[model samples]
Target: MQEIIVSWSRRRADSPKTFTRRWKWTREDRARIEFYRTELAGCISSATFDAMLEGVNSESLLPFIFCYTVRLKDLDLGFVEAGLVARSWFCLGEGFENLRRVLGPGPRDEGFKYIEDEVEGEDTGYNDPDTEPDDIYVQEQFLTKQMPAGAEEEGALWFNVNIGAPGNYLPGLRGVIRLQSRSTIYQFPLTALSGWSAKYIAPLLFLPNLQELEVEGHATIGGLKDQFYYPLSIPLQLYKGLKSKVKRLSLVDGRMRVDDYDALAELTGNLEYLQIYHTYRYEELSPQEYASIASFFRKNNRSTLSLEEICINDIPGTDMVDVN
Candidate 1:
């Protein structure tokens, strides 16, 4: 089968032309067509996903748009150029909605079981008395044989089974791709994204397991002052919503009012680590900026926060001058 990313892009080809289209079809599609003309219907991956995803991390799915979704435990848009990050998040937010329509809303119950037991040639139990033999043949061929590539575009479905539950029925960890449940995502760190990227933060609620979040200065909730960006109440609501389980929060570069911390302090119940990071130029920081940054740590007594350690610009490997 084609890599899911390439297949995903190709799937969008028929979608009403937008920007004349940047992403489309795939190498595999053409490769399949060539093979068919040359009499070799298709090829196969000798290497299996079971071998590949043994210890997959955020880096494993790099450059794949799927990496940006809930499958990734940590959502770090800071790596991309700030301009492109907006598009990345927007596409991701939209992708989730599209997938939700297929997978259905609510939590994804399918466990991400990368490791699978050997079940080759076992009776899959998919061949129920009610199931037609033709349906059974399709299921068996999909798991056993290599079909032609462009065949899918021609309305040829190699494998049609229940989306979530593969079980021993689907039969191999070799080419398995599991869509992660809502509980898979935990850490979401959003840098101060400009323009529309901040608006897409509302989708974070989709990941019910998100715990650690890093909020940027410009992306802070609400516009209590001029220095901060315009009303960012949408993301603020995502972070501070009653259902949120955000534990470790790092506040970076917010030049807002002293009272903003009061709201943030109450966002999480057992906020283990609250770190304040000044991401911009340290020397040029204004007096008012310093107050906005400092006041959060100072006035936390009133909030129901069970903070363990409060870190303020605790950069590693930096020398400190003694003031004694």
Candidate 2:
């Protein structure tokens, strides 16, 4: 069996001054090599490419059979076999972006159908009843850069762009693109939280295969002293736009008004799990407000709601009490 072992990190003992040549691949490394060589090699070279194309029409299925990383210089036969893997996913340093640019235009130009349906006869187990959807990770900046030019036009807030458009390239090339549960973080700029959420977060709610979502708000361009703020209307708009597709939701490090609780109570009927941590800046909930929230969950108890988990925590200075 052919094997390729790569080790990018060096321990202090592996330094030049160590003088003793004790460096060797560990047992775990050998196992990884074997798995890649035997199982993954065949799957990538043939199966993954066909799956990606079929996924374009199947909204519930993800196109990627598996995700793996390879180096730019190492785009050998084996590397090309690993379809849909993000080049930046495994790069050792800063040059991955440049490599992405070099590789980007070719796939876009050939139009995702370049690979013929040679592997369609293979039993890739993509349709196994027990199979789970693949998880796609997308950074906030990456998501923003891909948004269509008039994405926010006509009060639509969010809608799917054409597959040929630069912003909508990923779905066309990779297929339905399901995101990983809890692992994928959807970040929005703290400086423009309301506007960003309106444009980007709205579309995410409609993703056909997305079941869980976690959103983090950070100030990439400013300091925390900036004290991010948004009206109750923003989150209300977000909750109103959410489809029944997502069963779990988490929001972190953002601010919403006290009245947003009414919106939350109205929106969470279809949710199975909900978590709000340090995301709201409202004053303490009045007795009536607390009762209203409790009533919403209590009313759903005898129904189909699998909403067994709910958490709400406020920032330190905010007088809001914890909700279970």
Candidate 3:
């Protein structure tokens, strides 16, 4: 599933323009079109995008736009795969920005550039060695610099230019594009983003109106420790920095410690619903952690306080509330 960011001022999901679609046709196909259209549209509109998706039957139409609600203003779906039903659902939105960063173009060399390694695929290791191509390719890469552009009301807000590679210099390539002004979601694969530190992830905090943030990957929550040390702390800080007005937040196969939960509780005081999944045993907290958790709930309790659902994948016991 993907994360969506919507504005607080945006119309409620129940509104017609925000969730419905209309198309006209002649009497011949009107009954069939209207029937399927109504049924498909209602299925999408009835629940939040993250809810379990109903099967899309229209293979003839552009599956992307056909399966999703076109009325949403802006959304941010993370680590989206190619050609899946959900991926098509994302393409329906106003924008679909890709955020996977690639190594910049290789270096510029006036002299003859030599190819040392064999190409990974195919019988021939060489790429027409005689023909001089337009671009140079670099192999070894280091993080030399990070240039952050100011938040623009339109166009891409952040872009990274990678400069060097192993053998040759290629033209720098730009990655991590953000089209913030448009009411659309950004989508990319989780594996595409292999090594991201707080520095790379921190600026997302500036997007105050972000309605939802979703990350998808196969790495189980317990495996997060293998990816980065102190994994939960930094993410917790970013969550805290997020504007409290955000209604929905999701982390998939990402580590969440008890303190992280406390941090989320602290930041999203107005949150109506919250969920966590694919994590380790959510054992009852030790006495100290329990106290801190109690403090968190007390401080962030909503007036309606409709639902507070904490789901841990590997926990052993029944639900227990620690008011101590």
| Model 1 per-residue lDDT tens digits across residues 189-266 | 232222222322222322344566654423332212223343444335644544334455565554433344444443
Considering every candidate listed, which one attains the maximal TM-score? 3
The estimated TM-scores of all candidates read 0.34, 0.33, 0.37
What is the C-alpha lDDT profile of model 3 across 171-211, one tens digit per residue? 11112122121212222222221122222222332334345
Range of the 10 consecutive residues with the lowest summed lDDT in candidate 3: 138-147
| Clash count per candidate | 0, 2, 22
lDDT of 2: 0.32
* Residue 164 lDDT (model 3): 18
TM-score of 3: 0.37
lDDT for each candidate structure? 0.30, 0.32, 0.30
Candidate 1: clashing pairs of residues:
none
At residue 130, candidate 1 shows an lDDT of 29
Full ranking by TM-score: 3, 1, 2
- Candidate 2 residue lDDT tens string, 31-135: 454564455342332222222222221210121211222111111111111111212221322222332222222112222223333242222222221122111
What is the alpha-carbon lDDT for the whole of candidate 3? 0.30
Model 2, total clashes: 2
Angstrom error of the Cα, residue 120, model 3: value is: 26
